[model samples]
Target: MHDFSWGQLVNPEFYIKLGGIYLVLFIIFAETGLFAGFFLPGDSLLFLSGIYSKELIQEIVFIKSDFLNVLLLSSLVSIVGIIGNEVGYWFGKKSGPYLYNRKDTIIFKKRYLFQAKDFYDKHGGGAIILARFLPILRTFAPIIAGIVQMNKGKYFLYNIIGSIAWSFLLIFSGHYLYKIFLNNLDFDLKKHIEIIVLIMVLVTTGPVLFKLFFKKKEGEDDNSI
Candidate 1:
C-alpha cells in the first residue's frame, strides 16, 4: 500500500504514479470535500488525466477508449465530485454550531466564517457554481453555504451545472488539444507533459487571480473615497 501524506497531495504525479483509476477519483473527491484536500492539484490533475485518459484506459483494460469514452468517464467522475461536495456540506451543517461557539484561534477564526457568510449572501446561488472553478473557495464555499443554511434546491441546481462545466471543460480541453497538437505539429506530448500541466494550472487559475486583484483594488478605492 502506498503511504499517503499531505506533501504528496500537492502533486498530481503522486496519484498518477500510484496507478489506478480509483486513486484519481479518490483524489478528486477528497480535494473537493475535505479542507485538508484544498491544497490538492485539482486543475493539473484533470489536465493530466485528459492527456493520459486514453493510455490509462488501455493500461487498465488492454483496449483504447476513444474521445467520447474519455468524455463520458470524466463526466461520471464529476458526479462523484458533486457527491463529495455534498458530504462537505453535510459536515458543515452538523458541526457548524459547535464550530461557531469555539474560541477563535489563529488558524480558526469566527470572523472568517462571517466573511464567508457575507460573501455567500452577496452572490446568492451562483457563488456555488462560480466557486467550482476557484480553488480553496470551492471546498469552503459549500461548507459556508451549509453553515448559513443555503436553500437546498438552489444549491443542488447550481452545483450540478458547475460540476459538469468544471469537469468536462478541463478534461476535454486537455484531451482534445493534445490530439490536435499530435495531429498538426507532430508533437510528442509526453516529452513536455510537465510544461503542459504547468500551463494548464496557470490558465485555470489566472482568471480567479485577475478578478481578485480588481476586487481588492475596488475595495481600496471605496475606502479612499
Candidate 2:
C-alpha cells in the first residue's frame, strides 16, 4: 500500500494525501471541535473522501473496498463529528466567562462569539442542527449553545441527528453517484477534481452569503424607516 508523507498533511496542494482515512477523522474532529480549524475544508472533503474510497482500498489502504466500507466510514465520521462538537461544547462551558471577556486578536475575535450567541438566540436549539450545513456557524454553534447553558439532553439529540444527516448526505451521495457514473461519464474526473471541490465549497457557503445579504438589506430598510 502507498503511504503518504508527513509533509502532505499540511500542504494545501497535497492536503488530500494525508494519512488516508485517519486524516479524514482528524479533519472532521478539528473542524468541529477546535476553534483553529475554522478554515479547514469540510464539505468537499467529505464528498471527495467518499469518491476516493473506491480506489483508496485498492491503491492506498490496501483492503477490499466496497460501498459498505464507505457507509462505515460515513458512520465513523458522523460519530467522530458528534464527539467533536460535544468536546467543543464542554470546552465552551469550562472556559465560561473567560472567553466572553477575552480581547480580540488576529485569530480570536469577540465579534465571532457574539455572532454565534446571536445566532443561537435567534434559532434556539435548532441552530445546532442547521449549523451543521453551515461553515463558520457550525464550528461555533455548539460552543455558543454550551455557553448559553442549553439543555445537554437536547443538544446531544441535535448533535447526533445533524452529524448523521451531514455525513450521509455528502459522503454517501458522492459514493453512490461515483458508482453509477463509473463508466458512464466521459470526462476526465482527475482533471476536474479541483473544479468539483471549488463547486462544493461554493454550495456549502451559499447560505451564509444569502444570510449576510438579507441582513444588510434589512438594516438598510431599518435606516430608511
**After superposition, which runs of candidate 2 have C-alpha atoms over 4 Å from their true positions?**
1-13, 55-65, 99-122
What is the C-alpha lDDT profile of model 1 across 1-225, one tens digit per residue?
557786665666667768657777877788768877787777777777877786656555654448666876587669978987888788778888987898999899888778877777777578888888777778787787888767777777778888888888888877888788889998966677667657766776888889889999999999999
Model 1 misplaced stretches (Cα beyond 4 Å) = 1-10, 58-65, 100-115, 217-225
- For residues 11-73, write the lDDT of model 2, one tens digit per residue: 322445646677777888888799887777787778877777655444434446486678777
Candidate 2: worst-modelled 10 consecutive residues by lDDT: 7-16
Residue pairs with backbone overlap in model 2: none
Query: Which pairs clash in the backbone of model 1?
Result: none
Output the lDDT of residue 94, model 1.
82
Taking all chains together, each candidate's TM-score versus the true structure is 0.81, 0.80
